[model samples]
Target: MAQTLQEILLAPNRRPKVVEDVTKLVDSEVSDKSGVSGLAVKSGYALIKKINSSFVSDAVDSMLDNFVGRMEPYYASYKASGTGSFTEHLTANSSDVADALLGVTDDRAAGSRRDSVKKVYAKLRPQAKKHVEEALPRLGALVEEHAAAVNTG
Candidate 1:
């Protein structure tokens, strides 16, 4: 009608139907330790910020080349435009083409893609020096900024 444990701390004689209990002594202090999930959340946020920065920097890296490549035709248009139909007259007669190409117009509305591009060119002095020293620009080998940096590190 009863059983006995191999209780090292108790005697078998009267270890009662409702036996004595053992309890732990808690210090009642809260730990300042953080969990793995919190760390993961922080790291995930950090990674998102890093990814966003790189996306913009990748854009900045191409800013000069792409912008000049775009505006070049307009600058070339003054040379290229003669006079003719709607499209032809549009390129020649529009004052905004020169103004926009020179970064004097609604570039602010375009978020200063023009200024950002100009800064890219302004920052190229060192690379320009290196190419001039290396290539010794001849007649036909005139260095376009876009073509100059090609195949370089």
Candidate 2:
């Protein structure tokens, strides 16, 4: 049987490292942003971090399971296809992949008690898809790296 992303990534031995890598991926994505919207993203991210020092890591940890769940179908498809990198598969299905990931955040934001956090999320949500789409390649690479690690280790 093929290993699920949840099984590989959410395993107790691997979850922390996956979370840390995801946090770094997010940080890099945010940092690499440019232009007016980029500034907003960077600033909003900074504000959120200031609001809670561990917010990024905490969010990643909390959302990882859902994120992996959302990606499971796509991952399964990639495995079945047996051609092209996961990066390419994610890029080819960028809209669906990005939307699936964002859905997790949207749900989280909707249930958030902190008005400030909600406000920040609201302001950033408009441009989020483009940013997320741009990050898909890196996100794909990150997933592939972890999956490969498990295969080899």
Candidate 3:
């Protein structure tokens, strides 16, 4: 049977490598995009790498937790006030949201950041999800192989 992600992640020895591989995969997927949205993806990749390198435990989970927590309120407020999809809401308020999230000061920089966020929400979100899902089986296999090698040697 194929091991679930949580099953692999729960193994103390395997968790860090799994997290590293997943984060790297996500970063790669985001970085692989083209056009103006690539700017946001690159920024996001940098932030993810920074978060991942900052701790000994599961940094990706921590980042996700924080991101979700922060976003929930924004999403709720948007939902309460608007009728469109979240992407549409985000695109309409990208500059304000980007400024709030990133603390960008320069108007030009904020505009760029807003564009990046809009691109991510509007276009790249599904691709990012699919990329991660597609990578999981390969990552699990690598983990199994590593475990076997470690056990044998």
Candidate 4:
């Protein structure tokens, strides 16, 4: 089992340093936009939300990897005893991260502060689009690297 909420909240690994900077940058961009009286406000909230989503996705991936690692030894022991197939167990549970992340994107996108962040993305939709355009590639690269590591390891 995992730690309690209090422990998780206090855990050092849960903290990602870059989220604040990203939020601040997005808020500042929103503040510079014209005709939007509270673009900054929305941008701030949206940025937080976007970063939160990203963090959640990253956390899910890490968690599933950890879970699988822990399960492997137990699975091997069970398989050696002729209790079950570790491969079957692994495959059945392997969907944890992928399914969770896809659900987060699909269900949470509508709520990602993604669009809202863009709206305040400096009062210019283009600016927001540019940020997202750049961000997606970076995130995609990270995912690719992470997947490669998992596959090879």
- Give TM per candidate: 0.19, 0.97, 0.37, 0.26
- How many Å off is the CA of 62 in candidate 3? 3.2
Query: Residue 52, candidate 1: how far off, in angstroms?
Result: 3.0
Candidates, ranked, TM-score? 2, 3, 4, 1
- Which residues of candidate 4, in runs, are more than 4 Å off? 1-127
Model 4, range 26-118, lDDT digits (tens) per residue? 445445454453454454555655657565335334443343344334344434666434334434444442343343334334454556443
lDDT scores in order:
0.30, 0.94, 0.47, 0.40
Model 1 Cα lDDT, one tens digit per residue, 1-97: 1111112112234222112111000001001113553343334334534645443334323342333343445435533554433234333434443
Can you tell me which runs of candidate 2 are displaced by over 4 Å? Answer: none
Question: What does candidate 4 score on TM?
Answer: 0.26
Error of 2 at 67 (Å): 0.3
Residue pairs with backbone overlap in model 2: none
Best by TM-score: 2
Alpha-carbon shift of residue 101 in model 4 (angstroms): 12
